[model samples]
Target: MAEAAAITWALELAVIEMFEHICIESDAKVYVNALAATIDDCLWKIRALISMSLKLSS
Candidate 1:
């Protein structure tokens, strides 16, 4: 959960600044996979942030 929140905040910063590129590194597979999961399937509290992160990926 801490990992998710941190990633979310970083993503939000990137979004706000209109950064063209962003990279994320993690040692936790579960949280990483969860963020990469499809929006429709994810049930985590950070779903909104996950969706935003996914959008940034594309």
Candidate 2:
């Protein structure tokens, strides 16, 4: 879950960086921590997907 949250945060940052001006908001601290936990098991796949999304968005 931590991995997922980190991926989400990364993706959000990527989008913000790509767009230049935009407000990103999230109220789920638990979800954010979930992504930051570790890139193990299925979390790695989630991270890959987020990375791909950022690349495609860019």
Candidates in order, TM-scores: namely 0.65, 0.33
Give one digit per residue, the lDDT tens place, for model 2 in 17-44: 7865444355655443433454343245
Q: Which runs in model 2 stand beyond 4 Å of their true positions?
A: 19-58
Q: Report every candidate's CA lDDT.
A: 0.74, 0.50
lDDT of 1 by residue, 11-53 (tens): 8788889888888898866668776566777766767767767
Instruction: Flag clash pairs in model 1.
Output: none
